[model samples]
Each structure stands twice: as C-alpha cells, then as structure tokens.
Target: MQPDQEVPPRVRPGPLRWIAYAMGAGLPERHRTWVLYDTTTRTWVWRHVVRTFVQLAVPIALVLLLVPGAFWIRAMAALGGLILGMAFSLAYMTEAVENRVKKAGYAPGSAQAVRDLAGREREALDSERRRAAAAKRAVRYRDRRNR
Candidate 1:
C-alpha cells in the first residue's frame, strides 16, 4: 500500500489473446472481446483442425511439385498426407494446449488439477448420497419398531 512501492506493469494483449484466454489468462477490460466459442477446449480443437489442414495441404503441394506424378499418384499422396496430419495432430493436441496454458501464465498441469478436483467433488457427492440413504433406512427401521 506504500506509495514508494512500484506497481507491477500490466501485460499488453497480443494477437493470440483468445488462445491465451482459453489457456486461463486474465483478460484486461480493454481487451475483452466477443468470441464465438467460449470454452478453451472448443477454441483449441478449432485451432487443431486448422493446423491439420495446413499440415496436410503443404505436404501434398510439395509432393505434387517434386514427384512429377500421375493424377492417381498425387491423389494417393494427398490421402496419405491427410492421414498422417490427423494422426500427428491427435498426438500433438495435448502438448499444444499445455504450451498455450504456459504462455498464458498458468503452471503446467493446471488442467489436470482441475480434472482431479472435479473427480474429488464427484466422489464426495457419491459419499453424501450413500450417507443420506443409510440415514433414511435407519429412520425407517426406528419408525417400524414404534408401530
């Protein structure tokens, strides 16, 4: 609270603000904007889709240029490229999201922490339900004894 203490400077928002937001970055009021997909997973999936397309297209283009192949050959190469790109993207998605989260100033495994918390909450709710059922049965037995 001392006037002599220097305040930390605010970060200037960048082009990847939406991705950063998905990765748990706090947005400044000035930089907050409308987004079509609200959740981080949705935005990340969309990004992955785009990246997969780009990856597939680039390799296909290179193959067509360098291979001097018949139409069927080029088409097969394109198919292979698509398959490979999809497989790579599937493997890469988790790493990509984690990197984005890190860039957004979150600790690595923050997403996992959230999942673990949710699991604990579910277990607690289940335990409470079981306790409530036991209590109800106990009350029913006591009432029957008094009948």
Candidate 2:
C-alpha cells in the first residue's frame, strides 16, 4: 500500500462507543429485590437525615418552651436523639443491601441482548479480517505466477 493510501473502512472501537454501550447496560431502571432495598435504603437515609432534624426539633422545642431557658442543653439532647433515631434507619439499610445480594442474579433480557450484540460484532470483525487476508493471498499468488 502507498504511504498516502487511505485506511480501509474498519470498525475501530472508540472509548465513547464502548462507554455508550456500558452506560446502557448499567441502567438503574430494572431493580432486583435486593437492589431495590439497597437503593431505597440509601435514598431513605438521606431523607431521614433531613427528617430527623424536624422530628427531634418539635419535641425539643416544646420541652425548651416549658423549661425557663435551656436552649444549649436542649440542642445537645436533640443531636443525641437524632443519633438514636438513626439506629433503626441503619438497620433497615443493612437489610436492603442483604436483600439486594440475595436477589442478585443476571438481569432478564439485558444480558442476552449484550451477548448477542457482542457475538455479531465479533463475527463481523472476523469476516472483515478473512476478506483482507484472502485479498492479500490472491495478490501474492498473482505475483508468484507472474515471476
């Protein structure tokens, strides 16, 4: 081939192409039981962090209202109460992770589709290589016969 010869049209796997497929395969759409639990727990924990403030504040505020003036001490108790409330939340979160692992198995149609696509891609690449090799062989045969 000449130095300036244009490269043949071949599929060169690029990072973007590979990542697009990977992104498609790694969707958060189909949640297994375990995955559902784990994901829910993580989400709930964040929500609870916000809720705990409101939950602890009302009772603490009431007590402070009844008492003369114990704002600082009540604030400390409220912080501690928040920690106590988190125990149950953490337990549920642990359960969710466990459920996810328990129900953790291959996805329904996703795995099969990925496998089929990969197989087709490989077959296409193989065919291209075979065609190129055959062309090279034909050129070599003609050169030898000419000599």
Candidate 3:
C-alpha cells in the first residue's frame, strides 16, 4: 500500500445501523423489537410479533359485513379492508412508541449508547432466529429417523 494514498473515509453509524445489520445477517424475517436514537437521549423502539392471527381477524370481520348478492365485490372488499387495517395499525404502533420515548424525558436516538443498544438487539434477534432454525431442523431429522 502506498503511504501517500488517501484511505476511504469510514461511514458514520446512525440510528438505523441495527436494522442494516439485521438485514445484512439475513435475519430480517425474525420478529424483534428495535430501539432508535434520533439525536436525543432516548432511542426509538420497534418490535415485530406473531400477530398474523390477530391481523387475520380483521379480514374475517370484513367478510361478515358483506351482503349476500355481491359475492365477488364482497371478497374484494374484505381483502382491501384487511390491507388497510394492517397499514393503519402499523402506523399507529410506530407513532405510539415514538411518543412514549419522547415522554420518557430523553430525546429519541441521540446517544451513542442508544446506537450500541440497537446493534446489540439486532445481534440477539439474529442469534435467536438461528437457534430456532436449528431446533426445527433437528426435529425434522428426528422425525425422518423415526419414519
């Protein structure tokens, strides 16, 4: 390496660093909560849960609201309703968490510690996903052996 050559500048980390790490590690599908630090003492938080069953209830409710003659339209309306419901629910969750963080007397995503915490959360989620996958594979192997 030539000493005179200028080295590329390192990218400064931000509140979204943990999300990038999780996506990079191939654990984006895993459900986890993430905290974000904006420029305040407190960080932002996000969590994914197995809410499919709960979310599905919206579609079912829509189906129940349909009248008898318009079958196709009923089905379409149900699908659209389900989608809209989920979209609004997600938006509400994000806003609520941000408000909570703000009320906690800290600015969201401001501190170095918050950034590190987000990274740690991503790592923990990645590890959990790997463990679950391994367990699933072990069960499948054992079932095959029994067969």
Candidate 4:
C-alpha cells in the first residue's frame, strides 16, 4: 500500500470510555473501525471475556466493600456474582458484540460479516495454494517417470 493510503491505527478508548463501553454504551463514530477490530479480530473472544470481567468488576467490588458481612461472606458474594454475571455475558457474547458494532455506525451483524468475508478470503488463498502444490507434484512425477 502507498504510504499516503496507509490505514491509521484504530483508536483505543481511554479507561473511562472503556468502562462506559463495558456497560453497553456505543463509542463515538470515529471509533467505528476500532469497534470492528475489537469485535472481529482473532482474539475477539478474549476481548469479550475481558469486557465481561470489566462489566462485573464494579459491582463485585461494591459487594466486597459495602455489604455488611464476614470477610468470607463478602468474598463468597462477590464470587457468586462474578460467576453468574460471566455466565450471562458469555451466553449473549455474539449478540453483545454485534450490538457494539452496530452502535459504531455499521449495519447489524457487520462484525460477523467482516469475519466471514475474511474467512472466505483465507479459504480462497489456501485453495489456490493447494492447487499450485498439486500441479507442482504432478509435473515432478511426470518428469521423473519420463527420465
């Protein structure tokens, strides 16, 4: 790609923005590319898991701090909340991610669409490579037989 046409780095939201994002807020339109990248990258699942943890963090912390109980009781309460929260978050992982992508000004399912397109492109390239390799093998075998 030409230097002038190079893509800029996706803008990562700051901590506050990230917290808002974990709470289901859509990022600003300028962050559209970042939102797509965040949802469609190879590590997207990990990103989702981390976001889920972030979503649970505040409530869990509050439970540990404010709810009157023994230390073990508070810890147990926080643990239960974390487990239940993660379960729900992961259950709707794809939908939640798609929602974020849509909020970034893209159409619904845009993240999955982008991921699907990339997978197809990769499959095409792999098929081309396999065909080339088979042709090379056939030519090598024919040349050896003739010799």
Best-matching candidate per TM-score: 4
Choose 1 or 3, whichever is better by lDDT. 1
Output candidate 2 Cα RMSD.
Answer: 19.1
Question: What is the lDDT ranking, best to worst?
Answer: 4, 1, 2, 3
- What tens-digit string does per-residue lDDT give for candidate 3 at 23-120? 22211222112223322222332232123335466456758575665777877777777777666756665454444344434365333455567678
Best by lDDT: 4
Summarize candidate 2's per-residue lDDT along 13-65 as a digit string, tens digits.
34554243222222233333323332344254564344445445566667666
lDDT tens per residue, model 1, 37-71:
12143254676566557546657788877888698
The digit string of per-residue lDDT tens for model 4 on 20-105 reads: 98788888877778989999997899999998998888999999899997989999989999999989988999999999888888
State the local distance difference test value for candidate 4.
0.90
Q: What is the C-alpha lDDT of each candidate?
A: 0.61, 0.51, 0.50, 0.90
Prediction 1 global C-alpha lDDT: 0.61
TM-score of each: 0.46, 0.30, 0.32, 0.77
* Residue 35 alpha-carbon offset, candidate 3, angstroms: 15
- Angstrom error at residue 45, model 3: 10
Q: Indicate the TM-score of model 2.
A: 0.30
lDDT winner between 1 and 4, please give it.
4
Compare candidates 1 and 3 on TM-score and give the better one: 1
The Cα error of candidate 1 at residue 45, in Å, is 2.7
Better of 2 and 4 by TM-score: 4
Clashing pairs in 4: none
RMSD of 4: 4.3
